[model samples]
Target: MKAAFAPTLEGWYERHRRDLPWRHTRDPYRIWLSEVILQQTRVAQGRPYYERFVEAYPTVTDLALADERELLRLWQGLGYYSRARNLHQTARYITEQLNAEFPATFDGLLSLKGIGVYTAAAVASFAFGERVPVVDGNVYRVLARVFGITEDITTTGAKKTFAKLASELIQPASDPATYNQAIMEFGAIQCTPVSPDCLLCPLQQSCNAYQTGRQQRLPVKAKKEPVRNRYFNYLVLRQNGKLVMRERTARDIWQNLYDFWLVETDEPITALTDLNLPDELAKLVQQGRLTGNPVPLTQLLSHQRIRGQFFLVDLPDTVSMPLPTGFGQYSMDEINQLPKPVLVTTYLNEWLG
Candidate 1:
């Protein structure tokens, strides 16, 4: 079964592979870009972003030279801003330190910033034609079900088990890249997490999960931690037509993105005074009247759910008011240019429009 695995998967890929732009090239920079953009993103959703990035910064040198703010702006709406930041940092590292050349080996690719084992194997196998298997979520599901690996995938021992099996499976493959892509593609389209197409699956005969009817239970992933609920009260100070916003600098979610003055609470509040703002903020709130009611918004992240209540405080345009430290007033044009969390963007569109 191990000897024929790669050939069967490669055959399946030759017939079922989707025509994606990244598959057409072996350039490491483009391949790396696609991998970074597609992290935590589906292909259908990430394809346009990939095209935009390739069009905007065609090479490692171009990416390294891009302004951080502008890059973040381009990467807005793609959750996990750290991926974009890491991509930029790695690009610069490659351009300045490595003469704009990607490391050709799996070990070398793993040494790059934010390049994990999965990413390293993907770049090495796909871009450099190295005989390394890419073991991401899709691979995990495929290997677990076909081999009936019931070990919890989140544990270190399970990871080693899967990695060892993956390495062994790729040894017989004539083309490592095609075999890797085929298994991942098969997992995604045929053996999906829910309602897998087992009826017409090519691997049905060999798939232990299908034969045992344990397809949904083989890749034993542990339950995730409870989602932490946070309440964010945004004080949107506006004068004339400009609004006040600041870049989040804390070592927390939405870092490097722009948002209004935020006051987080353990519980939801109905009124501005519930915030018990500092004297300076209270004075600012006093100077301005609330505009209508507090607009509510919510965003769900990987492990946190944020409920935001935006309180619009319209100060008199006749006299300029001092904003809180690190906060700056910007026109609608400027606000439109800044990178912001999806929650902030939703508020701007729904409230301002």
Candidate 2:
């Protein structure tokens, strides 16, 4: 009976699948590109970035040669920046070490930076025609409800269970790429996270959760970790028609992306009056080198809530500027060329646009 459903799914997939750009290609680079961009992002949101990336870096070698900052600039506003960083790293490894060939085997793909089991399975089957099953969030949901799986979808152990079940169901000699694509698409558009259309669902008649009326409760997800709040005070410092920007080198959020001079706090400040500027800037402030009023902004990440305050300071030529290493001065045109955080970019776009 489970084997019978595979053909039903493939048939439904052929008739109802959305015309996504990645589906029309067998290129491993393009397939991997789509999978990476779509991670933690909606299809509608990720599609443009996928298109832009394919245009910008047409091949794996092109991606490997890309400057990290330029790649980050292209990937701005798409949170999970670590993905962008790893994507570049993987591309470089493939180009230089693998002779521009992506790993054809699932385990080989998994050996690359940022390529986990799910992503590895996706590329392996979709691009290489491997028989492995791809068990992503979508697959988890569809299988949990249809097969009556009670395992918490968030746990690591659930992956093995779901993968085993999916592998069993994949038809012999069936196109694993098409089967994988069909299941993911079915989960994306049909077995959605919210309010799935069970009434018209193809598997409704045979779905165990649907029959048991537990569809909403079967694919249980673990509770997300509690988020911490951080306060940021960005100094948009300028002197002699140039602005100061620094690269985040520490093992922190937004690593390798450009940002302004920052003062972090555990609590929000009522006013900029309580700034603890470095000695050089404080001395310049004694002579009143500060210009515009501080601007306030807020950013929300997966595990962090950030309240940002921007202080615009204009220094004089006579004043000696004290900058830490990994910092640079750039004109607006040059600044436009560097990759920045969306918060920084959004603020600068108004001033520079």
Candidate 3:
């Protein structure tokens, strides 16, 4: 059964694969970058980011030595900021601990900060030509449809089944890079989650779901949890052209990235007086450091909702508000050079400009 499917998929791949920049190169470092950037990101959106990362880092060593803030800044607008941080940390680990060489084996790659099972398989196969199966969302969809799988693919058992099947079906005579890409491409272009164009699919003849007329239902996914709402009041205080910003710690999203002063509440605070400003904020007002009341701004996240506030402050010539621990004060112009989360950028454009 495997023998029959391999050639057809490979032949279809050779003729129909999209011409992408990453496809043109077989460099491990480049391959790793593409895989990381593409996580939770679409091909069209990730392509420019991939090109930018390649241009900025150029090599593993360059990525290793890059400043965290600058790296985060470059990764701005691309959500899932943890990936960027992990990429930076792993690069440093490879350079400092592993002597600047990426791990050659699947296990070795998985040991890195951000590389998981799918990423490990992808990097190992695509970069090293190892015959490992790459079972990402796209591959899962294709596999489920071809095999007529109806179990929710989000389940552990389903994942294991798919992985086992993928390992068995990987083309033994073909390059792992091509095989992995072919399956991924087949899913993205033909076996899509929505109304798939089964008529044009290369696997149409052999696909079980297509034969049963249940293509849309094969790769079943579990329902998502409802997003929680959050309200944030951001204080964009300025003193002599310097804006107050702070680093998001590990406790929150956009960790290690910069943003305006954040005041979180369970529900929206309509009155400025209701927000008991911290001593620092009160001191700013008492010392005539702040000129205006708080203004509300709202931002949304995939799993969270945020309503923020901006307080434009003007400080006395001799007075300075105590900076938050672990945060540094930056002139608005200098802030432009720092890597800030997109929400911060949006706030800045509205208030600072």
Candidate 4:
């Protein structure tokens, strides 16, 4: 079973692999960019971003010299901004410390910050032709079902088991890169978590999950923590055709992104009067007139659900009220250029029109 496994997947991959742009190159920089962009993103969604990034920054040095704000703006819609930030930091480190040379081995790549086992193994195998396995979510699913692994995938012991099995499985493959990509693609297209196509699978006969009719049951994983609810009240204070916005500097979600003045509440509130605002903001609100009805929007993150309500206040052009600290007025054009949260962008598009 072990000997036939690698060849079977290789043959399948030759006939089934998609023509992704990254597959045609052996450049570690491009490969790393694609992997990072596609971490929590689908191929269909991340492909354009990858193309834009490659076109913008063809080499590690180009990426290293890129403006952080411009980079974040380009990476706006693709949530998990930390990935982009880390990508930049790593690029800078490679350019400055390592003379723009990517580490050639898996262990060496792993030494870099944010370069984990999966990423290091992928780069080493795909670019350097090293015989190391890449174990991502797709690999986990493929191995768990094919080998009839019933261990809880979220547990530490199960991680070790999968890693051991993955390492052993890659030992016989003639091309470790092809074998790694083959299994991941197989899991993505054939052995999907739900409604896997077992009828035409090459490994159907040898697959324990298929024979035992437990395809969905073999890869046991613990349930995720219940999503916490958060309520955000945004005061869109506009005056003289400009909106008051501020960059989020808190060590929390949406850090470094621009948004309107925000007030978080323990519970949802419909009216602005319900808020126990600061003395200055309260006096200012008394002077300004409320615009159209409050616009409500919701954005869901991995572990939190944020429900936001926006109150547009139109202050007179001659008002002398001092703006809050960290807040400044910006024209619509400037606001459009600033990197903002998706929720804020959605509000602007829907309400401003």
Candidate 5:
């Protein structure tokens, strides 16, 4: 199986691989940048960000020296703010500690922030020819189905198992990078998560899932937590062209990002009229702080669905906000410059743009 694996897959890769920007490079930094951007992101969606980042910070040292706010701005709308933060930290560590060179060995690479085993393997194999296997989502699906392994792919144990299996296949290959790239591309294009092109697959005859008619069931996952619903009411305040914006410091979704005055509810409110605004906000309004109404909006995250209502308030010139420290007013220009979550950015563009 290992003897035939490389030639069979690498042949397919040579003919069918997509002409992505990162694929053309042997540079580890460029490959690392693309890998980080591609995690949990579609190729089409992440390609632009890869291009932007490459253009913005041509070198690891350049990224290391950038301000956090500026880095967050570049990473805006790329949902996982933590990845961006980790990327910045890793760049700094590499530039300052390692003389701007990515660690040559997989284990050394893993010591860097945000570079997991999979990422380490990918970079090490592709850039340094380290003869290690790369197991990402695509690889997991392909291997589980091809071999019809039933171990739930979601668990940590499954990861080591799959990585070991993948390594066995790659170790015998003439070039590990070619085989690694082939398998990943094969999984992405052939053994897809949904509605795979089984008929056209070259490995269909040998595929255990196809033989047993269990393609859909082979790559099983442990049941995740139930999808949770959350209600968020944002107070979009404006007084003499100043808008209320707060840096979200809480250890929640969009942490360290900017948002508006928020009120979270346990249950969804069908209408703004049903919601009882906080007493402090109500008292402030009565004391000539502002007058407002709600604008409905909602966004879906992986584990949670958020239904949001924006209460736009216009304050009188004489009143001042009793907002907490770190909650400040911003002009339209300043507001546009701050790093905000995608949901908040959408609202601000519609209401204040």
Candidate 6:
């Protein structure tokens, strides 16, 4: 079966692959960046970011030397902020410790920050022409359907099984980059998660799942847990022409990004009078640090719900308010340069209107 899989996949691939930007280059650095960006992100959504990152940091050395704030700023809209941080750190590791040289082997790439097994295999095969199998969501779906595997694809056992099977099927004689792209593209466009275009698929004649009338059920996914909701009250304090914003630190979701001063609660506070402004906030009001009254704001996340308030405080002057430890005041223009959570941006555009 493994003997047949590679030729079948390669044959389908040669005639039907999308011409993408990353596909044209075999540069490991670029490939590595694409792989990292595409993690937990769709290709369509990631493409623009990929282009921006390539334009901004054209080399491993460029990414390594970029300021963390600047990197995070560019990655603002993309959730999963950790990926950007890891990418920056990994570039530094490759340039400084490895002397601006990328690891030629799978193990070496895997050792860098956030380079997991999937990324390592991808970079190794695509950039270095190593005959290593790449396994991602697409591969899992395609293989499971073809083989009628019933185990939950999220389990460790399923991963090991899929990896082993993929390894046996990788074409040793083929261009690794082409082969990798072929399988992935086939899975994405032909063997899609929803209704697949089986008629256009080259493997339609021999596909086990199609033959068995179980294409929808073969690649079983584990059920996801329910999303938890959270509430946030943001104070959009303003003085003169500047707005008060703070940087979120290591413990929060948008770590190292700037946002308005926030007070979170489990339930929605219907009225502004209900808010218990912290001592610092009271002091700001007493000192005429606010320009306008506190306004209510609400936001939602995949797993969290936020109910917030915005206080357009008019400051007597641009005197810096005492911020929470690790937070600092930024001007409104400065806010534009800092990376902020999407929710913060939403609040800003809504109230500032």
* Model 2 residue pairs with clashes: none
Task: Specify the poorest-scoring 10-residue window by lDDT in model 1.
Answer: 316-325
What's model 5's overall lDDT?
0.86
Tens-place lDDT per residue, model 6, 1-353, is 65666677878777777777888888999999999989998889989999999999999999999999999998888899999999999999889999999999899888888999999999998889887888999999888887778889989999899988777667563666666777888899889999998777767766788988889887987667665566666666666667777678759677887876676777766544455787877777667644455566556655555555665656677566676565566666777788988777776677673
Clashes of 6: 10
Model 6 residue 45 lDDT score: 92
TM agreement with the true structure for every prediction: 0.65, 0.63, 0.64, 0.65, 0.64, 0.63
State residue 125's C-alpha deviation in candidate 1, in Å.
0.8
> lDDT (CA) for every model shown?
0.91, 0.85, 0.82, 0.92, 0.86, 0.80
C-alpha root-mean-square deviation, each candidate: 17.4, 18.1, 17.9, 17.3, 17.4, 17.7
Residue-wise C-alpha lDDT for candidate 5, range 1-353, written one tens digit per residue: 65776788888899999999999999999999999998888889999999999999988899999898998899898889999999999999999999998899999998889999889989999889999889999999999988888999999899889988987888778888988999999988988988889999888888899999999886999779777999998767788889888899888999888888787898866544455667766766565533444777788988888888887778788887787567899998998789988888888887667
1-353, model 3: which lDDT tens digit per residue? Answer: 56777777778888888999998777788899999999999999999999999999998999999999999999998899999999999999888998988898899999888999999999999888888899999988888888888889889999899999999888474677788888888878777889998888878888999999988777888767677877776666666778777778867788888886676788877654565777877777566544455666666777676666666667676886677676667987888888877767886777666
Q: For candidate 1, give the lDDT.
A: 0.91
Off-target runs (Cα >4 Å) in candidate 1 are 227-353
Greater TM-score among 1 and 6 belongs to 1
Q: What is the lDDT of residue 185 in candidate 5?
A: 94
Per-residue error for 223 in candidate 3, Å, reads: 0.9
Residue 170, candidate 3: alpha-carbon lDDT: 89
